[model samples]
Target: MGMEIPDPISIESVGTWSDEVDVVVIGAGMAGVSAALEARASGASVLVLDSGGRLTCTSAMAGGHFYLGGGTEVQQATGWDDSPEAMADYLGLMSPECDPAKISAYAEDGVEHFRWLESLGFEFNRSFYPEKAVVQPGVEGLSFTGNEKCLDVAEVVKPTPRGHKVPVPGDTGGAGLVVGLALDKLDALGVEVRWETGATAMVVDGDQVVGVTWKNYDHTGAIRARSVIVAAGGFVLNRAMLEEHAPDLLAVESNGMALGNTHDDGLGIRMGQSVGGVADYLDKVFVTGPFYPPGEALRGIVVNKLGKRFVNEDSYHSRTSAFVFEQPDREGYLILDSATMVQPSYRFQPLVDGWDTIEEMEQGLGIPAGALAETMAAYDEAAARGEDPEFHKAPEYLVPLDQGPWGAYDLTPGKCFYAGFSCGGLRVTVDGQLLRADGSVVRGVYAAGACASNIAVDGKGYASGIQLGEASYFGRRAGRRATAEVAQR
Candidate 1:
C-alpha cells in the first residue's frame, strides 16, 4: 500500500489579527532589509517581519558578492570603462530571454543604487581579480569585456567595478555583517522589527492589498499590517514547492553555510498570487552545484551522474548549480584524491575530510567507484596537459589529484535548504514597480535583490555581493517611493 500524504496546512487556522502600518516588509533577508530601510528613509512607519527567528535570510548566508557598476573603488583604479548601457548589454547577452525593459532599468538604476548603498554606510571594495583562471578574473571581466563588452566602448563611460563583497569570510558571518548594518539603520529610522513572525498570507480588500496576516512560530495568533512588502524570498526550501514548481531539477542540496536565510519559502509569492498579483519567471529557477553533505564543514567538488566532471571545478556557485540542474538524475559526486585531500585547493580546503573516503564518499555522495576513478583520471590528464579536456576549462592554473585515500562526495537532488541556483522570482519594471503578467504594475509594490530579475548583469548566477547592492539600491528607491505615496495619501 502507498503511504498517505497529509493535506497542505492552511495558515488561517493558526492565527488571526488586525493591525495597520505604512509599510509591512516581509522576510528579513537582504531584500526585506533593504526595502524596510528604504521605506523608513522615506518617512514612513514600517513593520519588518520574518518567518524565521533571525533577521537575515539566505541573502545573509551568501559569499557577500554585490554586483554593481560605477562606484566600486576598484573600477576607478583598474581603468575599466563601464556604464548602465554596458551593464544592460551584458545582462541581455547572458540571459537573452530576460525582459529587456527590466534589464535596462536595473542597469540604469544600478549606478544610483550603488551610490545609494555607499550613502547608507555600506562600503564596497574595489575590484580584485579572481584567483581561479577558469573563473573570470574580475567582476567587470565577466560582463563588460571582449566581444561581450558593451558596444559603446569608446564612450569614456568610466565604469566602476560592481562586485562588492561584505568584508566577512563565510556565509553565516557574512549575513551577520549585512544584517547587523541594516538593523542598526532600521533601529535609527524607527522601523518596527518583529521577530518570530511568519506571514501566512496577504490581506486583500477588494482589488487592492490592505495588509498581511502573519503568525508566530509557536502557532500563536496573527498580526496585521496596513501595507505589506512581500520580500519573503524564493521557495528554495519548500521541497513541495520545488517539486511542484521545478520538477526537471529534482532537489537542491547545498552547503550548510548558505548566505541567505533558509526560511524564505516564497510566502510572498504565494500571497501575491492569492491577491491576483501577476507572478512571472516561474519556469526560471536558479540552479547551483552540489557540495559536501550538510553539517560537514568543507568545500567539495561536483560530478555528473556518470561520475564525470562538468563546469569549471573551482567556481563554488557554478559548481553547486551545475550539480543541481545540469547533471542527470539531479545527482552527482565530488571527487577528491589524497593529494587534494591533503592540501585541498583553497576553495575545497574547508570541505576536505569532512566526510568519509573516496569509496565511502562515493557511497555517501551517490556515485559508482569505477566511474569516479575514470573522472579523476580525466581531470588528471587535463591538469597534466595544462587544460580541462572535458569542459575546456581555461588552463591558467592546475591542481592535480594523484594521491590516494581518495574521496567522492555524493549529491542527489534535494531541496535547497541552504544554497542553490539564482534565477526567476518577481517581475519588476525597470523603474522598480512590481509587475503583473499582463504588463500591468501592482500598485504600492516594489522588488529588489534575488527576488527580482533583470539585474544580474553577467547572468553567472548570483554574484558575490550584487544582491546586497540591489537591496541597497532598490530598497532606497522603493522606500522613497513608498514614503512619497503615503505622504500623498
Candidate 2:
C-alpha cells in the first residue's frame, strides 16, 4: 500500500474535548516550526505535534545551504548585482509548471524572507564562489548552486550567485536552521509543542478540516482547531510508497539513502488526500552525489556502456547522476588520464581502472568497437582547440587528455556512493493552500517543505538550500494565511 489514511472518528466519541487551539501543526521539522511561529505571532493559539521527541529530522541533517538571492542582503553585501526578474526567469524556465504568480512573488519577496531567516540567528558568511561543485567546501556562504553557468542554463537567465550557505561554527546546516528556529522562535515564543504523537486523521466538518485525530493522554481524542498545517515531510522513508511511487529509486539496491528519518512517512500527505487534496510528481525523486571532482574532471569524458557521451559532464552532480541511471546496462565510465587524474576525488573509488593507453582501457572495460576511441578523439581535438562543440564544457576546464595512462571509473548506481530524498508530494499554491484536481482549495489546511512539492523536483532542477529555503519561507506564509483565514471566519 502507498499511504494508508486513517478513517475519521466522530468528534463527539472522545467524551470530552482534550484541548483546543486556533491552529495545529503536524511534524516538528523546519516547516512545522515556521508555521507554529507565524501563526502564534498572528495572535492565534498554535499547537505543534511532532512524531519524534526532538527537532531532529532530515532538515537537521542538511548541508545548510539555503538557495536565497534576488538582491538579498548577503548578495548585496557580497557586491553581487542580481534582481527578482533574473531569479524569476531562471526559475520559470526551469520549473515550467510552477505558478507564475508564486514564482514572481518568490523572487520579489525573497529578500524579506532572507531577512526573516537572518532574524532567527541563521548566520551566513558573505562571499561568492563561481565553481562547479555540489556544495562549496570552505565555510564561505555563497555559490552558484544551480546550472546557471551551463550554456543552456545561461541562455534562459543570466547566472547569479544565490546559494546562501549558512555559516555554522561546527554544526550541520539543516540542524543549525532547525535548532535556531526551535529554540529561539518556537520554544521561546511558548508555542504548545507535543512530542511522541502526531495527527492520524483529519476531522472534517463538511468541506473544511476542523480538527485532528491524535492520542490525547491515552485516548485517541480529536483535537479541535480552526486550521491544520501538514508539514510531516515526504514519503521517502516508506518502502511501500517507494515501490508504488518511485520504484526507480528502490531498484538501485542499497545505493541511495532517503532524506529524513522514519518519521518522514507520508502520513501527513495521506491526511490531506483523505480530504480531497491532490499530489503531483510523485514519480519524481532527487538522485544525487558522488560528483567526480578534481574540478578538471570536466575536461575528461563520461560514456555509457555503448561508450558514447550522453550529457554535458560539466553539469551538476544530480544531472550527471540522473542521466547515468538511463544508460544501457545502467553503466557509464569516466575516462581520465594521468595528468588529469592526479588528484583523485575521494568521492568514489577504483580510481578509473588505470591503463597505459585509452585503447587498452577501452578494451579492458569491454566498450563497443570504435565507440570509446571516436569519443575520446573528438574530445581531445575539442580540448586542444580550447572548445567542446558537442557538450560545451567551459574553455577554462578544456584541458587535453593527451599525456597517456588513461582509465575509466564506473558511474553505475548501487556501485557509486549516493544519497538523496523524495522531491514530489502534495501540490500546493504559493500561499501554501493544498489544491484539488478541480482547482478547489482544501480549506483550513496547508502544507510546505518537502511535503509541498514546490521548489525541489528532480536532481537536475535542484539548487542546494532550495528545500530548506522554500520550506521555512512558505511555512511562514502558510501560518499567516491559516491564521488570517480563521480571523475572517
Which has the greatest lDDT?
Answer: 2
TM-score of each: 0.69, 0.95
Q: Write the per-residue lDDT of candidate 1 for residues 305-355, one digit (tens) a residue.
A: 666776554443443454455567665545565555423222331332344
Q: Pick the candidate with the highest TM-score.
A: 2
In terms of lDDT, the poorest run of 10 residues in model 1 is 1-10
lDDT of 2 by residue, 22-114 (tens): 999997887888888889989999988877767566788877878776898778888888898888888787677667887787888888888
Total clashes, candidate 1?
A: 42
Cα lDDT of all candidates, in order?
Answer: 0.55, 0.78
Model 2 per-residue lDDT at 194: 82
lDDT of 2 at 179: 51
Q: List the residue pairs that clash in candidate 2.
A: 60-175, 64-173, 65-465
